[model samples]
Target: MKFIKTVSLAIVGTALAIGGAAAQGKTVKIATEGAYAPWNFTGAGGKLEGFEIDLANDLCARMKIKCEMVAQDWDGIIPALNAKKYDAIMAGMSITDERKKVIDFSVSYANSPNGFLVAKSSPLAKMPGTGEAFSLNSQKEAAEKAIDAVKPVLKGKTIGVQGSTIHAAFADKYFKGTADVREYKTTEQHDLDLAAGRIDAVLADSTAIIGTLEKPEFKDYVMVGPSITGGMLGNGVGVGVRKGDVELKKGFDEAIRAAVADGTITKLSKKWFKIDIAPRS
Candidate 1:
C-alpha cells in the first residue's frame, strides 16, 4: 500500500524501532538498514552508530526536529518508506533513477565508491589495475578491460553484496555474467560469510568495509580492487523522502551543507572510518 494503515505502521514501529526513543507528539521515524556498518550499523550492545547516525542526529538538531532511528531490512526499506513507516531514509541509500520514480531525494549527504575485498590468501588479492578512481559510465572501455582482466580469476567465485543495493546493481551490470553473485540481507552478513569462507569475496561500500576490516576476526581480509563510482552507482548516498514535503527536504539539504562547511562530516567520517570521506572529491 502507498500509505500504511495506522495499525500496520504501529506494528512496524515496534518491530523495527525497538531502540527508538519516544519523544513528544511529533516524531519522525527514519528508516535505515541498521546493518550497513560505518554508514549505519548496530554496535556491540546492538545500538545504532556510524557516520549516518551522527549525521542524522546532527540534521535533526539543526532542523529542530524530533527524530527516531528505525532499522528496516534493506529489501523492504522503500516499501516501508512509501508506507509512511518512516519520514526519511538515510541508510547509505543511493539516489538512482528507479528510486526517484517513487520517492524524492534531498541533496546528497555523502558520496563514496564501491570496492571489492578478498581474503589476503586469495590469488586475486591484488587488483589488476587501480589508481585513485575510475568509472564505467564515462570510461566504459577501461572499466570493461578491468573487468575482463579479473574475469578468469573471479569466474565461479561467489561474491556477496547486500540485496537490492547499488552494490548488487554494480555487480550485475559488470560481473554477473562472469561470476556468481550472492545476495545477502546485510553487509555484515557478507562480511561474516567472507570471513567464514562461504564467499570468495565481497563488493560493498569502501566506507562500510573499513569497519569490518578493523576487527581482529577480519585480519586476513584485504581490500583489493579498483574503487568505482559514477554510472551504476548513482549519485552517492542521499536522503529518500516521499514526493513533496519540500520543507523537510530543504531543511535536510541545508543542514548537510552546514555540516560539511563546518567540518562536522569530516570529523564524523574520521571517527567512524578512520579516514576523511567528507568530501569525496
Candidate 2:
C-alpha cells in the first residue's frame, strides 16, 4: 500500500513539474511599428490592427504561447530588441544579411515586392516596365536595365523613402547621386510628403503604396516601375529575434511553417493585402 502511494506521489510531482515548465515557456512580448499599414498599424482608439497582428495571434496560438504585442518605432526596433525590449518583431521586417549580423530571423512568412509610387501626371510615370517583376538575385540584368531606364527621369528629383528600410537602401545604392533621396521616420510621413508635392516619388512596398493610393486623397498617385524583390531586399518578411534566442526563434519558425502549410497565411494575406504574399516554398 505504501509503495503504491509513493509511486502515485512521484507521478503527480512529475506532472506538476511538466505543467510548470510549459507555463514558464510561454509569455513572450512582441514589437511592431504600428505605423506600417496593412502589415501593422494603429487603428481607431489606438488599437493595433492589420495583417501582422492577426498573423502574430495565429502564430502565438499555434506555438501554444501567450504573446503581448507592443508598438515600437521603426528605426529603433532592432536596437530595442537587442536591448531586450521585446522578444520578437513582426512589423513587416525583412530577413536581410545586414540585419542578420546583429539579430536572427525565422523562415520568411511573406514577400511583398517593392516599387515606386508617383503621381499619374509626373513625367516619371512614363518610365518603362509597368508590371514586370525583378529579382536582384535571379534577374539582375533585368533589374539593372529597369533601374537604368528610370534614372534619367528621376535625375535631380527628390525621392522619399522610409529610413532604415530596404527601400532606403535601394535608393541609396541606385539613385544617391542621380537623385536626392529624402528619408522619413515613417511611411505615413513620406506618403504625406509625396501627396503634397514635396517629393517627386516615393519608394516603398507595393502593398503599402496600394493602401495609400486607395485613399480618396491619393487618387492621382499610382505605383510604377518594376516590382522589385530579392538581393538587398533580403529573403522576405520574417519574425526578428535576438541573436542568441535560438529556442524562441525555433518556436516562431515552427509556428510559421505550420501556418504556411495549413494555408492560414494565405487566408490572412488575402484578407489584409487583397493578394497572396505568402513566401513561395
Candidate 3:
C-alpha cells in the first residue's frame, strides 16, 4: 500500500459537515480480533493499542459517539456482530462480496496486500515475483504468471492459513489440489506451527507477517512470493456493520472519509506498521 500523499481540504470540510449532522450521541460497541498485531492487538497490559484501535477512536470522536471496543475471536466476529453483540467491527476485515451479503461495510480505511511467509532456507523463498505486487483485476496476466511460476514449488507442500480469512479462501482457490491446506483458528497458531516446522509455509496479510517476522522466534521466516491483492482479497479493510444499520454505516463512512481527507489514517498506519497503508483516494 502506498502512503497518502495529498488530501483535499474541500473533502475534509464536506466530511466534517456530514459527520456533524449525522452525530447522534449514541454509544457504539466495536469488536476486533485482539491477535492481529499492528492492526488490533493486546499490548503489555492487555490493553488494545494498534492502528485500528487508534483509528476507531478517531472515527468515533468524529462521529460524536461513545465507543466501546471489545476483543473478539476472529472466527466469531461476524456472527457476534449479527447477533447484535456489537454495533460494528473494526478488525482487519476485508470487504468481500460474500461478507457484504451478510453485513454492510463502510468505505475502506486501509489497503494492504497479502503474501506468504516461508523459511528463508526453503526453495520457495526463490519463488517468482518476490517483491512485486499484483492486482487480480488490473494485473490479471501478471498475477496468473506469478502463480504459475510458483505452482511447482508449492505442490505437495503443507500450507497453513487462519480459517475464515481471505488467506484461507485464496489457498482453497489456488492450492487445494496442488498443496495441503491447513486452517487454524488464529494466525498466531499457524505462526507457531510454522516455527515448529509443522507447516512448509503460511499465507497471510503482508502487514501481519511483518509483525510476525519482528518477533525473535520468527527470525528464520521471511515474506516470500508475490504480493497479492484484488479478487477474493476484496477492496482493502473497512468497518463491518449489520445490513440493517444503514445510518450507522453512513456515519462511519463520513468519519472515515474525514480521516482519510486529513491524513489521520496514514499517520496512524505509519506509527503502527511503519508503512503508509492509507486507502488511496
For candidate 3, lDDT tens digit of each residue in 1-281? 21112111111112222222234433467888888887988776667777888888888778666677888888888999899887889889999999999999999999999888999999888877888889987998888788787888999999999999999999999888999999998888999999999999999999999989989988887899898898889999999988877778888898899999999988998888888999996
Q: Which residue pairs in candidate 2 collide?
A: none
> What lDDT is reached at residue 147 by model 3?
78
Top candidate by TM-score: 2
Count: clashes, candidate 2? 0
TM-score against truth, every candidate: 0.87, 0.91, 0.90
**Candidate 3 residue pairs in clash (backbone atoms < 3 Å):** none
Candidate 2 positional error at 112, Å: 1.1
Q: Write the per-residue lDDT of candidate 2 for residues 1-281, one digit (tens) a residue.
A: 00100000001111111122234653477888888998988887667888998898887777666667888888888999889877788989989999999999999999999989999999988868778888989999988898888888899999999999999999999999999999999999999999899999999999898788878999987899888899999889999988877777877888899999999999999998888999898
lDDT of every predicted structure (CA atoms) = 0.76, 0.84, 0.83
Q: Which stretches of candidate 1 lie over 4 Å from their true place?
A: 1-25
lDDT of 1 by residue, 1-281 (tens): 22221111221121212122222335767887777787877666657777888788887776666677877777898888888778889889888888899999988777777778888888868667644467767887876677677777888889999889888988898788788999998787888889888999999888887888888998888886777777778876788987876766776788788888998988888898887777553
Q: Between prediction 1 and prediction 3, which has the larger lDDT?
A: 3
Clashes of each: 0, 0, 0
